[model samples]
Target: MSPTFPARRRGKARVGAALGVSATLLAAFGTAGSAQATSATVRHGVFPTVSGAAQIRANAVGQASSDETLSYGGGIDGIGVMSGQPKVYLVFYGSQWGTQTTDANGNLKFSNDAKGGAPVAQMMFKGIGTGSEAWSGTMTQYCDGPLVSTGATSCPSGAAHVPYPTGGVLAGVWYDNSAKSPRAASGHQLGAEALKAAHHFGNTTPASNRYAYYVILSPHNTNPDHYQNAYCAWHDYNGDTTLTGGAVASDVGDFAFSNQPYNMDSGAGCGVNFLNSGSAGTLDGWTITLGHEYSETITDQNPAGGWTNNIAGSPYQGQENADECAWLKGVTGGVGNVTMGNGTYTEQGSWSNDTDQCALTHSTVS
Candidate 1:
């Protein structure tokens, strides 16, 4: 995740760094600079993870390509993607996630979730907008309006896109055992527990959190902000002042969040078998790390404003759209098993500026 460097407008600068895979082995994931804000400007978007011999030496030296693809980092308060009807709440954070129940296909069960992973993350967010799911149709072709033009990688005719979650973006779920989560919980206490889950899901306002999102989750063996040494999840909004107990003000406008730890406790370096193996791939890094921070908080919700890879010196500058297909496996839109309507999980594959690449399904743009 952490790459985005340039910023002077919509609070951009996320510098946790280390993800171009090979500048001396990505300098062993080093780089950290963020924590100077007088009026707040630190947006952050990081989901980095690369061990296992740095992912086999970054797949034998052939993975540094980000010439110029994703764009449109123009809207902040006006928001960018998740243009409409995309919700996902799921809080769960604390009391070590014990005692909660409902199974029998009603979903949302707990009892310390040994690895059941909270009903497979509520049936993968109720099987993401059901059967015709083209993997959420590759983010309905990226968008934002007002005539789209701040780095615009594409998206013009009528703009305001990113829809497709027709009936499932799991708009609710909470546990908040309320006082056991912070084993490592920083990032402004996970943005103040996502503004206390937007006042416990009433969704305060800013039009009920403009296409909301707030997965804080974090229990089973805990580690919220350090995310088990670096990141297996990341996404921000409470106006990221380099979070770690900094930003997080929100009077109910800048929402969007994520920090979702508990990726089966980082096994297999955060993707358990990378794609499917014995035991049907134990949660496969919990739905590919929560569907890669839920498609980067519905297309850069409030970090870098929306959509990224501004190309300043391009090494996938501040990546987004599932960080340009993280953890690629088989090929052709990497990582597999997408199925959707209530089963077959293992996801990974996003970033498709009209088929420029990395698009496991795509074909819904509108």
Candidate 2:
């Protein structure tokens, strides 16, 4: 992820330039309950400007004729999905998010007093796992290999297939008031706060957190770890120092997290591009960005060690699957609005190595 240095703030470290560790290291030090997660590649998209948009469009990675895969020397073992029932927990990190309610389908709904994007995020997470949505299956095409940097194409025999989150769970929600505001919460601070919530929910051990990820949301009107400028949102495990104020690799487990602010502050910069429908407060971008991070987390749970391209000098390299297809909309294998059981959502496509294309739907896991 490139850093968005605010014009007024000249010397601060760009939040996108944070240090990242490997899942192998986390495995060496993490306890059983704290294990499953590993350090992930911090893939992020820059805020789009007219000139920037033109440049990115010219250089953007287009859909491939078949699934794409990087060589083994690039990182670690191959990348794979959660391979189990996935789980997600939502954290409203500040008081800015007010009360919450439950909709008819047992999905969490926030009060109107809260930012309009909040409830939409909640519903998208819930609705995506149901109705046999094809959006998610787009991720199943990726698989992990047993050897590091070997360029071995096939997954090891008996390797777990990227299971569809058939019965994915929205384990719980927490409104933490301790932060009170996102004005100064650093990336590390956000990870620590997520740890606090994990502790509160007894999700501390790796076994307890298997296939589980935490999403830390900053409120509107404030910034968390430079979100307004540097990047819209990002997903990473604990212990990645590359991010300013991130947890130390040795001290934390393989817990995954993403810090996002309400996108109204900077539309394309904060992930409200393409199908934003010309509304600053629209939930389309919010849900799409969230889905992007979620898909990346499960596939590249520990960053490059999972699945990532490592081409030199190419922004697209080292990018997770979703990053490759970030803003490609309306073309074959690009972004489009799809109807789920709850409602229609404008989401982007994910890269699939199987067909060597970016696809919105996968008839089967392959």
In terms of lDDT, the best-performing candidate is 1
Candidate 1 wrongly placed segments (more than 4 Å): 1-73, 78-96, 99-110, 116-148, 154-175, 178-193, 197-214, 218-253, 258-274, 289-291, 303-305, 308-329, 336-347, 352-355, 359-366
At residue 80, what lDDT does model 2 achieve?
A: 36
Q: What lDDT is obtained when candidate 1 is compared to the true structure?
A: 0.71
Query: What are the lDDT figures for the candidates, one per model?
Result: 0.71, 0.57
lDDT of 2 by residue, 1-366 (tens): 211111111112222223222222122112212111122212232222223323444544462333244322222222334666667888888766666667676655556334367666767777776787888887665555443233443455555555676644467777776647657577677787778767877786766655778888877776665544334566766645455554534223467677766766665544455675556326666777788888887776644445654433343534567766666666767768866767777787877766666778886463
The TM-score leader among the candidates is 2
Per-candidate TM-score against the hidden true structure: 0.32, 0.77
Clashes counted in candidate 2 amount to 25
* Model 1 residue pairs with clashes: 4-318, 187-244, 188-245
Query: How many residue pairs clash in all the candidates, one count each?
Result: 3, 25
